[model samples]
Target: MKINYPDGRIFNSQPSKSSLHTTNAKKKLIFGDRGMTLEEEINESNKYYRAHDIAVIYKKPTPIQIVKVDYPKRSKAVIREAYFRQASTTDYNGVYNGYYVDFEAKETKNKNTFPLKNFHQHQIDHLKMCQKQGGICFVIIKYVELKRYFVMPADEIFIHWDAQFDGAKSIQLKDIEKGSIEIKADYNPTLPYINAVQQLIESGKEKK
Candidate 1:
């Protein structure tokens, strides 16, 4: 199936963020042995959370605008054309321990930096707004080359986003190490990110 926007542009496919996705005649990403993409790992973790009553997080589904459909059979209809109904905000959002948790997940092959270009201005703005309303907002960045994960607070992301105007196009790994909580990719809950969320909540209290 293919989807195209009304403006004559194809909107069905997107670049793969998985470690298994090859690129530029080089090894693109890293997933060690599990071979799971960042999003897959997070989804598995979310399921674990829901089953144990730890958190109620979920991937936000993007609504599609249907443009064409074909009745291939009386019992079946095939969607031939569609587009995203609107620009979506974050990837996931829900309640965790009485606090609103909102975040985006990104994977990068860069070993020393996470490119700011991975994010859009609308996402930054949405996270900022969520943070303002007392939500635990952040980004979960997967460094595919290094096979590391970090839960970075939204404030750090804003700082780097604002600095892009001054020529900073990416956030340094060292800065992320300092300002974020690193979580090991583990079992049962593959990401174990909520622990980092607890850290963010505690760190916020310290700031107050």
Candidate 2:
């Protein structure tokens, strides 16, 4: 299999396998290539949405300050020193169906829990602000080892986040299953998170 990037880069997908070279140890290892990372899948999904006029969402680019640069050649320049200007608010934000949408994408290898440390304080605060302003704020989390994905509302996430000070540093998988909507993976939009968003919207309306 081959994946072509927007920048015209082609990546060939190879079967990843490992073997133990011993007389007694003849175990065949199989590596699962779950296609793309959470970020890449979200980006591709956003692109598909934008192309189909469904929504306009994009990844927020982090601001960086380049202090030193060297012109290694006439055609190419090398960056020597650069620093982040500031922390970013969220991973993605835009408008969809006349409603503001804001979200962050995260992935964890742990199957039992999703750590609160994966998120920043400022990001949580930003999500809270967005929710207060009637924006649809949520988080897309992927459990790599389990091959599962979920879309959790920001308000629900805050409960577990605030509980961290009480010694709970992570949200248990069972808790996530109870609070979030599982997004089915696809090939066209990759993540198809909008389905989960629609479910969230309908649930909110029902609650009201």
Candidate 3:
């Protein structure tokens, strides 16, 4: 599949586009390519929203504590090693339709269920804080095996997460089926994520 950008550049994958970058920490390289990593797909979807003036969102760069740096030459200083400052929040967040939107994008190759371990405590805490601040918080879960995605509200997620203390390690597929808004892949903009956002906002409005 090839998508020709307005700049006359044809992209075979989402990562090949200008807006997304992946870091090869081992190689110490930041490279962009024209392929669809799950991250790249979501980034591209966000770009679509931005172009339509619908929303503004971006991935948060992981906070890292630099331990050592080597300057082999005058032009560039190489970061030799670093550790995460803390567990990261969601993949993206921004304002849309005068409302704050926050969400994490995750993909699972597993056929049965998405493991809760994919999400971190700090992420849950961040989402809770955002919810407290009157923002919309949700998770964009991709069942890669099925090529399907769903948008699940933070409230629903919290319930299951809280149950983990009672010995539930993961949420079942049936649970997600009942609680999430599923999204199908598309061609024009690839994943139609903004549609999921719209559904989430409308559902929130209905509740009030």
Overall lDDT per candidate, in order of appearance: 0.81, 0.78, 0.75
Regions of candidate 3 where Cα sits further than 4 Å from its true position: 5-35, 70-74
* Alpha-carbon shift of residue 112 in model 3 (angstroms): 1.5
lDDT of 2: 0.78
Model 3 residue 169 lDDT score: 85
116-147: candidate 3 lDDT, tens digit per residue: 98888989999999999999899988887777
Give the per-residue lDDT of model 2 (tens digit) for 1-208. 4433344211211111111122221111111125455765687688778878999998776567999999975568888999766565986899989889999988899989898999999899999999999899999999988889999999889999999989998999999999999987776577899988888888878998
Report lDDT (Cα) of residue 112, candidate 3: 74
Query: What's model 2's TM-score?
Result: 0.80
lDDT per residue as tens, model 1, 1-208: 2311122111212323332244431211232226667876787688779878999998776567899999976578989998766555898899999999999999898999888999999899999999999999999999997999999999999999999999999999999999889999987687899999999999899999
Q: Give the higher-TM-score candidate: 1 or 2.
A: 1
Best by lDDT: 1
Per-candidate TM equals 0.81, 0.80, 0.80
List residue ranges in candidate 2 displaced over 4 A.
Answer: 1-33, 69-79
Q: Which stretches of candidate 1 lie over 4 Å from their true place?
A: 1-33, 71-76, 84-86
Q: Is candidate 1 or candidate 3 better by lDDT?
A: 1
